[model samples]
Target: MPIQVGDKIPDVTVMTMTAEGPKPVKTSELFAGKKVALFSVPGAFTPTCSAKHLPGFVEKASDIRGKGVDEIVCIAVNDAFVMGAWGKSANAEGKVTMIGDGNGDLTKALGLEMDGSGFGLGMRGQRFSMIVDDGKVTHLNVEAPGAFEVSSAEYMLNQL
Candidate 1:
């Protein structure tokens, strides 16, 4: 079954770009003792993801944090280099943490993997967002195919 409210985030390693370089971070360690607002896009730099998905979070980051969220994270089924570049392009530095699920390890673990072969993208994570408090899920918003309503930052902000 897919990850749901009340479930602990899966223990998996994902990559995040650091000043030093790309670093591997364990999901358990990232969420431990922290209230995190994490959103995942199908891929980085895509039209919807770049124009709306990521920008919404970047713009609303402080608002979300003000509500007691410790961190805001954005994960995509791309490599560290691509993720880092994309984050920079979106001006997400210090606002949203950009994570790379290069191998889809975390996405598969969450049971949110989707087949994007029809688009020549092979496999990717679905567009979704969740609130995790100290490693446990408090809310999850997953979008239906070709939809972009619930998972937006505006919607998540309302949830908070």
Candidate 2:
């Protein structure tokens, strides 16, 4: 079954760019005692992801924080190097936490993995966003395959 609202997100290890290098972030720790907005993209620099999905959160980082979100997390089925470079390239430093699910464990646990080999990208994540409070999902916005409207930061902001 797919991960549903109220499901306590399983604790998983994700690599995120840190001052020294890629640091491991435990999933439960991410939402352990905070309200977070998490969004996933197919890859680091893909078209819609770059042009719309990520920028939405970047532009609304302040608003999201005002709404009580402690962290805005971005996940991609990419390595830490790519995620770090993408974050820097996208000017995401300090505004968001870019997480790398290089092994696809978290995506598999959530049942949101996608195969993009035809697009020349290997296995990737389905685009989606969710509000996690105290480690449980309170609100979720799952984008339709190939759709991007509902998962934007503006829409998620309205929910908060």
Candidate 3:
């Protein structure tokens, strides 16, 4: 089933890029005892993702945290190296936690996969954002195809 507003976040393991190298992070532990703002994008450094999606989160990271969030996570299907480089390029190395879902297991588990072969992009994640409180999803904002509706940091800030 697709993750719902009240569902307990699934606990899965993934190797996220860190300063030293790939580091293990469990999904449940990521949101444990905190308000987490987690967002996913199609790919790293994609047009929309670079210009608006991630930058919005970086720009509003402080305010989002001020609104009671403890962590801001930006996840993608790319590997740790690419994710790390993208985070640096996006100027979000410290502001957001970039988790690499190299195999798309995490994105698929979340029911947010988007096929982009026609665009020659291969497997990708749908653009979306969630406000998870203490491991339970409290808010979900999934964007329509070619649209950026419920996934912007500003929009979530208003909801908070």
Candidate 4:
């Protein structure tokens, strides 16, 4: 089943780019003692993802953080390098934490994986966002396939 409000996020390894190189980060470590605004996109650099999805979070990072969120995270089912490049290109540095779920570990665990074989994108995370407090989900907004309404940063900020 898909993860919902009140569900504790599963412990899984996700990748983040570091000055040294790509590094593994545990999901539990990310949420431990923190209120996190975590958002996911279908893929990196895709039309909608680049033009709208990621930009929204980058633009509203401060407002989201101002509402008691300790961190704003952006995840995608791509490799760490790609995610890092996208983050740099989008000016997400110091604003958003970009994580790469290269193996779909976290996505699959949350039951949020979607097949994008028709587009040659293979398996990916659906477009969604959630407010997680100390590892427990408090709010969730999942967008319908190909739709982008409730998952935007503005909407998430309003929910907060």
lDDT of each: 0.96, 0.91, 0.90, 0.96
Pairwise TM-score winner, candidates 2 and 3: 2
Prediction 2 TM-score vs. true: 0.97
Candidate with better lDDT, 2 vs 4: 4
lDDT of 2: 0.91
Candidate 4 per-residue C-alpha lDDT over 1-160 given as tens digits, one digit per residue, 9 for 90 to 100 = 9998999999999999999999999999999999999999999999999999899999999999999999999999999999999999999999999999999999999999999999999999999999999999999999999999999999998998
Q: Count of backbone clashes for each model?
A: 0, 0, 0, 0
Please provide the root mean square deviation of candidate 2 (C-alpha atoms, Å).
0.9
Please state every model's RMSD to the true fold in angstroms. Answer: 0.6, 0.9, 1.0, 0.5
**Among all windows of ten consecutive residues in candidate 4, which has the lowest summed lDDT?**
151-160
Model 3 lowest lDDT segment of ten? 10-19
List model 2 lDDT by residue over 72-91, tens digit each. 99999998888999899888
lDDT of 4 at 153: 93
Residue 1 C-alpha lDDT in model 4: 97
Better of 3 and 4 by lDDT: 4
